[model samples]
Target: MKNNNSNIKLFIDGFKKFQKKHDNILEDTAYTQQPKAMMITCCDSRIDPSLITDTKPGELFVIRNVANLVPPFEGDLRHHGTSAAIEYGVLYLGVTDIIVLGHSNCGGIASLFSNQNKIKSSDFINNWIDIARDAKDRTLDRCKHNSQAEQINCCEKESLLISLQNLQTFPWIKDKIDKKEIYIHAWYLDLASGTIEAYNSDLKEFIPL
Candidate 1:
């Protein structure tokens, strides 16, 4: 953390790869952007939606925040970064799907159950992490006998479901869901095993994707 600016060279190197392939993509999407999905995920360095999904530029409209949490819809208009991105991606960009992608060993998720050092005292992160409080509660109640690791894994996935429900709290999102214009999905990535599990609406469980 000494030299925070040191990573710029890595980005510049990545951009070189991007530029080599950008010409063909820019030929069609330079004028308009039509991403396939509005994807919400965690800001963890290990989880990159584009890299995980094997998607190119203009393929997915992604929004990342701590724990990939989504707040309940409110009438008040303030600086809601994640919500604003969701609105723009869904309403403005006309994305056909919304994905709440969660992952294992998420630090934000661990903070929910942490008692060693308070992780939610930060100005914005504390209030932001509050959105997942219910998820932590549910995990504790459901997985009380499980190990800490298992509880966190459950909580991580539970947070995804909660966010998906919160997405429905937005009138436009609900209307679209009702009208069959857009669909919501939950996915869990196990970084250790390199396996992805998706929530099955019918069975009400997570299954390997």
Candidate 2:
């Protein structure tokens, strides 16, 4: 683990350097418009959506969340950052593509498979993670005899499929999909191999992206 004091100092120094570099980009982005393709990815530090896609700053509207799970449309009091971002990207920004990106060795997916009691009394996190609970259950039921790593891999792929299904629950998304104005895609990044696989709807399987 990083020593707290050193980490703090490093963060401050990094921020100082980031300010210098970010200012230039910010100025250019202010005058330029955003891209029409958006990517929803995991919050895992190892998985970078831009790096994986080799996209520039304005090339993709990216949303990062735990497990990259998209919950079904709920008009409740939840923040729904991912959903909101999707809505804005489609409705306001007129983005034509939405990519739900998942990855290997996901901690959130691992937590769903393990006992929930291990986590502290954090209802928000537990509730938020419930979005991927169905994926975990399905993985367990289908891969009952598989190894832990195999189960995790199943969940990772299943989570993307689940999110794709959830995307249809949004009325605007469904409308765009039906009119062929927008396309939804699911992708998986293998951290170890630095390879990405995209879901092939026709083949009903994941192939190299």
Candidate 3:
């Protein structure tokens, strides 16, 4: 309380308002969470799943990371945070839908367009963003005539499709899909325009929703 740090003060002040608004919310969702959908989205500060979807506390189970990329399923034992979350959501939570929420002006997707070796930190980011390598390649090949900005934008959407395909790599997810028990989707948010679009698998394009 003594510290005059604006960021900490902001959180402390904001929590009071949030607490007043959802005083009984904790009591309802404390012991269990039965979210209907699992959303894999970006870690961008501007992207708040609850606020964007206009959902309350236990309505959505959100998993956020760089670019919202989902790596293909692999059996070997390794630290798989995203994959683990997907498994928990699909199996234990019994979420009927898994949605990959991609957004515009994504730093992770933009990094894919640049030369990896040129980046100062030859560490986690490059490795992590590599999950969307295929998406970047597809973007480059398809949007050769477009500007760099356009290519990056194109890859942003392409990356969502790649995530959808990766979701199927999980055997359990595929089984659930086969039985029509669960569905996977790709959604893109244009931050500049404040527009949200859903991927239409039937038409093979993103449509405003």
Best-matching candidate per lDDT:
3
Q: How high is the CA lDDT of each candidate model? A: 0.89, 0.86, 0.92
Tens digits of per-residue lDDT, candidate 1, 129-191, equal: 889999999999999999998998999999998998999999999999999999999999999
- Preferred candidate (TM-score higher): 1 or 2: 1
Worst 10 residues of 2 by lDDT: 114-123
Q: List model 3 lDDT by residue over 1-209, tens digit each.
A: 57555568778888899888876777888898999999999999999999989998888999999999999998889999999999999999999999999999998898887652345576688888889999989998999999998988899999999999999999999999999999999999999999999999999999999
**Candidate 3 residue runs with Cα over 4 Å from true position:** 1-6, 115-119
Candidate whose TM-score is highest: 3
Q: Write the candidate numbers in order of decreasing lDDT.
A: 3, 1, 2
| Model 2 Cα lDDT, one tens digit per residue, 1-209 | 77756658877998899898765666666776678798998889888777777876788998888888898998888687888888888898888999999999888887776653355557677787889888888899999999988998999999899999999999989999999999999999898898889999999889996
Ranking by TM-score: 3, 1, 2
Please give each candidate's TM-score: 0.91, 0.88, 0.93
